[model samples]
Target: MSKRDYYEVLGVAKGASERDIKKAYKKLAMKYHPDRAQGDKSLEEKFREVQEAYEILSDERKRAAYDQYGHAGVDPNRGGGAGAADFGDIFGDVFGDIFGGGRGRQSRARQGSDLRYNLEMSLEEAVRGKEVEIRVPTLVECDTCHGSGAKKGSSPTTCPTCKGNGQVQMRQGFFAVQQTCPTCSGKGKIISDPCNPCRGQGRVEKTKTLSVKVPPGVDTGDRIRLSGEGEAGEQGAPAGDLYVQVHVRDHHIFTRDGNNLYCEVPLGFTTAALGGEIEVPTLDGKVKLKITPETQTGKMFRLRGKGVKSVRSGAVGDLMCKVEIETPVNLSSKQKELLEEFEATCTGQGAKHRPKEKGFFDGVKQFFDDLKS
Candidate 1:
């Protein structure tokens, strides 16, 4: 009988991507595999047909020739299909993503894991920078074995199962698949005489004291990296990096945003009415701030170059001080009398002395009058 179309055999479109073709072939290959056939010749034929289609469709040159001139262009043979697609590669392509890339390859030793250390700092400390010492407990190379994981007199032996190749080939009827050596667990070396300090793992737990230099203007969420300061790798691999995460605490008098600093300063009632100079706190000590005459509450004043100096940009930011009028509390009898006399003088002069208060009441009266009308 004439052969079926290659695309039809794999149940994929002619415009299917290479990943899609491989996905479809893997699905069909598993479904009609000889192990699941149970002596069914039709299922075996379907499996062979799927292989042939994949063989021609998988390769760029062969797929192009077959697409242009059909199966006659490639003149593919039976069984393995064109003899270009290896059975090991077919099995690997089917399960490579799940089993870590490819098979028959040496299993690489994993490097040390990166570590994170949370470093808390006051706002003053973050803005000025400091060098602090920290103690970190992590895995370090064993001193007894010197990271070899073997006794001092003896050394590691090659894995007998994989013959030091770190992989083993297993034959299942006609197909052979290579996988990590089970005897050595893919390390290709067996630690027959294990080290006493760290057993056979090559590393031990120890606390390391390290000094970290925190730069100025480092805000919360900033991280400083310390190279080769993390956990030691297995069998003499390179150590990972240590990241010191900074967390800036909330300030009592100031709040920072980007390069600017903001603080709320209480203004005396007299100072709000008659303009005066008051001291405002900054990162670089207190500075005298001038308040304008008739300045209202919630008025903001900017002191240039009084904020933090940025670590990355080296730019000096400004300090924003918002003044809020303070109402006198626990007043003496004389003070209460004076305040009442002052209120009496300003009652009829609301428009001249307190324009905002006069405008707000005028708006309220108009709103109620309009509702009645």
Candidate 2:
């Protein structure tokens, strides 16, 4: 079969720039890659064709020779072109861009993993702030070898298979494929004499005591970051961060929304009707809340500066107290007779004493009379 033009195979112009040619070949390679095309033999053949075209066109020397003498000039079968190693290196770069896997030496120093600690606090503690000590079990640098992963005097050696590159390249038809070195597991180095305390991991599990300062007004779901407090990195690299997740325990008296606090306060029937002052609890201390005369149930009273101050700002919120009137119960015989005598005085004063009840009964009577008519 006759071979197609290098430019035509990549769907690029004959005089296209190197960048344009690379972009065209990348699109074709990603589309016709064997892994992407499954087991289709025809697409695999097309992929090889695209790879061959890119190999010749991407190189200045090979491209010039091919332009002068056509396929005969750069054909490997004809023994007129660059060596197989040269093509492998070229395709390695192209494949590296398509996949994140690179052709260069990989770093062996791995960063530690970040950790989260859920810290529960009482409502009073959260509002007022406190500093407490926490015990965490995590990986720390091994003291025996000083986190080197090798014995006291010994050190890690470069991988012989990959020459410390952490990767190996293989020639597949007209393309070069790069993969992690199997011998050293892509670590680039091997620890022959493992550390006694941490085996070869360079870290050991231990419980660490850390002091965390809880900021004022930090509610549930808030986080405080403590840098370098997480798991120790491998082989003495920088440690990861520790996140302190705040979780406020449920309060018995108040419910917090943002910086504002809400609570229900029960009022005696006489105290609500006659008006009086009652004590309410706040994070600072107890304060007097004055109730107005003729106050009904579900009346809300706002106390300024009684709620939490914002952690991020200086603004203070108010406390909203909802009052519910409590009716007296379990009365004695004399008390019941006194309440009956009081009710008899109020019996003919429904419009004055119980206007809401009178209006409701009047609405019910009007509805029934209209239904009958």
Candidate 3:
């Protein structure tokens, strides 16, 4: 008898995907299986033909040979097809795909989740670095059961439902499928006597205090990672990590931009007119700031190497100070008279001493003259 084409027997196209071939084979196998056929000889013969077709077509080497030479390429009678052991391997793979495992298989364990903690630090502490303690509430491994979830002097036993396989196979109509054991919950073990503290959970919620060392020049949004400091894993698995997020508090004296520091320095009126050395505050200490004669308000002075030194690159930044001249207030009668006489002498000198004030009045006079015209 001439054998039919494998694709024709399976009722699938020659260019069909592996998945399509498997699907067609499964449907035909279900219809012609000997158990479903109930001892009918013809149906049993058809079942054998279907099995043979699947065995040859499912194998890459055999399928390739069969595609080129037809039935002569894979003749089971001529010892060219798969042997009994090879057939067993094929059956194992197909059955495993349909009804899951038949041998020993380990269940997957869960790992702990990572955690985050926000840390607030003062400007001085952020620039200089400091060690701080933080309290975190998380799950910790139970000591009574040693993370086994079993009571003292007791241990977990193999689940009778799955027989320690952690999975159970069920026959459904024409297909068999495997699922996690309901009784064991896929753990493959049963804890009859649970621990008193964790009550079979193997872990407990507790608050832990840990010390975190903040590095110098750590800006806001910087994170310090601490390994194995997060929540405890299930059944003594590996612990997760803890990330400490840094947040620097605002400074009252200076505003920091990257590594540079900016501040407003109040300059006395006499100092602005006559010019002299004034003391200015820096991160290191006070520095003498020399003011030029007739220095105007809002004049900026740059003091190099007086700002923050970068922790990453170790580069020094400058401190920029803006001068704001303060006007005299609460003058006595004699002081006011002396100021009026000094002002009169200064105005008599024209725009020599007060060029800015003279320019402002000159612009106003031009504006009125233009409006009259």
CA-only RMSD, every prediction: 19.2, 19.8, 24.6
lDDT of 2 by residue, 247-365 (tens): 67778999887789999999998899899999988777889999999899999999999999999896899999999999889999998999899899998899998889999999999
The C-alpha lDDT values of all candidates are: 0.81, 0.83, 0.78
Give the clash total for candidate 1: 0
Candidate 3 residue lDDT tens string, 1-373: 7777888898988878766776676567657765568889999898677766766777678787787767766764333444445456445634775644655455543456657786777778888889999999988889888788889999888889988877777777767666778998877888999999999878899999999998788765456889989877776777777878666666789877767889999999999999999999987789999999889999999999887777789887899999999998999999999999988888666689878888999999999999999
lDDT of 1 by residue, 229-346 (tens): 9888878778877878666767899988767899999999899989999999998898999999988899999999988889889998999999999987999999999999988988
Query: TM-score of the candidate numbered 3?
Result: 0.62
Model 2 segments beyond 4 Å from truth?
1-94, 97-105, 366-373
Judged by whole-model lDDT over C-alpha atoms, candidate 3 comes out at: 0.78
Provide TM-scores for the models: 0.71, 0.71, 0.62
The candidate maximizing lDDT is 2
- lDDT for residue 164 in candidate 1, whole number 0-100: 80
Full-model lDDT, candidate 2 = 0.83
By lDDT, is 2 or 3 better? 2
Name the runs in model 3 displaced over 4 angstroms.
Answer: 1-107, 155-190, 348-351, 358-373
